[model samples]
Target: MLPETVLRTDDVAPDIRFDVWREAMAATMSPMHISSPHSSDFWGHTRLLTLDDVLLWPVAMQASRYRRTAELVRKGDPELYHITLVLPGSGRLKVDHSGRRHLSTVNDLYILNSSQPCDVEVEENELAVAIGVEIPRNNFPPTAERAIGRMLGHRISGQDGFGAVLSPFLSHLVSRNSAHRPSDIPRLKRILLDLVTGLAARELDAEPSLCTETRRRNTFLLMRSYIQRNYHDPGLTPRTVAAAHFISPRQLHRLFEAEGITAAAYIRGRRLAEARRRLADPAQYTTSVQTIAQRCGYTSAAHFSRSFSAAYGMAPREYRELEHRQQLDTELRSLAPPATAGRDPIPA
Candidate 1:
């Protein structure tokens, strides 16, 4: 069945609302929230929340005096699974199982297994969005034991791993679902659940269980997408690219080999092509050839000019001038339209 609840604090006093949220959540799920100033209210700046389904909890919050304690577990049980992502701001988490207190800032991820308890605190005036996935106690995936009560908190930016793709994808879904149909929610739920399991397996360093190949393919597409987005970095070489994908140098090369190009060569070719196109543009007459070259990854002006001449059989300056004139003539021809027979031919 489709989820049937959208909860917010405006309906009640913030302190009372906090208690209501905790008890209401505990009835259908296993979780707890404790705050330092027990009398303080937290709703004045917080936003309304909608629960798509119990399989996932997506919440967006902006708080000024935001201080709270919370835990999530299986419905009607003390143990199960829960995961958290920090969409914004910075705070600290203390996981008893790990006996460590870690900081979570923008883009960091946090995971918790319900078999045990977790305690976390947020600073005042912090803003964040979080999604929690709840699963039955024994329903935890086979590799779940390894990550029991583990908190994976750090930026998994640029599609490096499951966290990278999952974070942005969930954020987009949660934001767009305001107008989404009920039928579409189930498919989205399955994807998020599968991703959570995959992430847990990864956190435990386990090889993918069944859908390994599919996951690998998705991850590759993700890495390629990141490359496209960062193509202008100039320093985006194999090493940097490998780091982004969280893979070994050999692995990075193999991914490219499968696509038929060496990493460095691909980057260089893209830079050169972008430079050539810019040089052929007419409206950019005032832009210097050296500037274009540097923008396209050439650091030395002399080397760039030499390479440009070799590639096009003329210096960039000469080529730009020729292209500029050609463009002007084309524009003039286009604007003047065709000459009619009644028009007299003029001397050249």
Candidate 2:
């Protein structure tokens, strides 16, 4: 139940589609000058997902230029920072901000400020695709502002370290579309903010200016994010996890006290949930249960089966077969219509 809006050129007359598209883009994002060779009968479609105070926009359109002119910035400032990630492509996406042009790469990210002038253009491709998120610049903690400032208009590698992890999370998040629950959408602000915060802090070697309570909260979030990314590793125990973060296993235990669950228990629960998801996925119907279990960090099929039976009241194989049959029954009842939901409007 994420709050989202689908924008398209089809809603307006062909001759005025570009004007309407520009208007909609400005209204949803910020004031900008948009131009394209296809402007006469421009074709563009995008989905905008509002996650708390932030916005996730996956944009698809014919090659176009978006420019936030200095005059426009002076006219009105939204005080937002826009970050965009372009997937691997034969074409190129370029961002010109602060008198410099940064060439986009397969897993490259760049940020633009609404309070400043910038120009973005897509070239050498029939169609351009990118996922962009707009976050309020004020969200950056004062202590970390300098480091963040230094990053403006520079390439942030979505291929390395925190960027690598953050990129996948965003790619998956957008792929989920409106299938997420309402609660899930609102909670995205904290998760995205935390991940970005950690990435910035690590990259810039600047610590956030936060109180003891805030530090603890952020640390907890960072630890959870790390676990989610590394859950498939068989060596992901509390001790190793703590060591990775420069904390003691005892400290990690203390961190989870608020949730009324132990770190080990949380890890196990995440693994089981992942395994169950694979079992129910129609795409993995041919995948063996043993392979799925091993991929989920289960070393022994027998142990995985027992754990699955205890938690889900069925063996892994049985659960997979049950889901497969239920899918067939659904198809039979509905005559196997095309999928109507859970699809990304802008493919990665």
Candidate 3:
């Protein structure tokens, strides 16, 4: 299994929770100056994943200000590059890097290098959710260094271009971390490295400098992202995807072959996963099974039913009903004070 750690403020006393979080951050990254209106009861949640020399931290925290002054950098610099992707949240996050201040909103990403002073301000009363990755500066390709330095202060769109793929990549790597075995670590590292280097270089129109292998992996990721965005369209097959990317069908299959899967299988797998997601969501509960199937690219309800059963061990309708039952049970349990045995009672 991949090595990971969870840091939470829930169990810590409100008065000292921020202090604990600060000390933890100091040990985890470089020491920073942190201030927040909610400091007395500051709330933060972070899951740290150790990916060899790289560290991935998916965090949700209350609004706060963080600064790494030159004094702090002088005292100790970890020499790492920090990439932060704002997943979803209200208000804005302001990041000052390389002498420029940039405002970031949901689905935006920015970079900060440990060798320089930086400032970050998260708006008050807002809970910001983000996926952050830290990689030793040395880990990046030399060809990317110049571009990365120039791009550090600018905002990158998490919803477009390479950011679209890289954002989801980090999020999934963290969210599905448990599904990865130790044997998967090396391959994950290689992918992570490729995405980071490839994104930076491509952003500044320096794609030609990247090695052929990095370029190949990036093409595969881009094609995967395209498939995901258009999976709702019924005609999104591997052949069509290849044509869209200006590659032959055989070439598309070769890309997946390197990953030990086939292109057609990957497309079907994405569709099935999308169907399962909608099936379990309560908001989609009222939607008809056939409608959901069509929405997920199944033109025929019967075919969708059979596919859903084979993938998830239940028919589409059966799965939706089962989900509803489970959700109702959960709601009923939450409302039943008797069932809150392990939870703390409200303060009098």
Q: How big is the positional error of residue 16 in model 1, measured in Å on the Cα after superposition?
A: 2.8
Q: lDDT values of the candidates?
A: 0.59, 0.81, 0.87
The digit string of per-residue lDDT tens for model 1 on 142-171 reads 454444434333223324466776787667
RMSD for all candidates, in order, please: 11.4, 7.3, 5.6
- Considering summed lDDT, which 10 consecutive residues are worst modelled in model 2? 206-215
lDDT tens digits by residue: candidate 2, 187-279:
677768766765666677655554455466567766777788788898889898899989999999999886688889888888899999999
Put down candidate 3 lDDT per residue, 1-348, tens digits, no spaces. Answer: 679999999989888999999887766667899888988888999988988988898889999888999999999999988898898664689889898988999999898888899888888778878888888889876777766888886889988878888888888898898899988988998888888777788788888888888888998998889998999999999989999988999999889898799988888899999999998999988888889889989899999888889988988888888888999999998998764468787899
| Each prediction's TM-score versus the true structure | 0.53, 0.84, 0.80
Candidate 3 lDDT score relative to the true structure? 0.87
Off by over 4 Å in 3: 13-15, 246-250, 273-290, 300-348
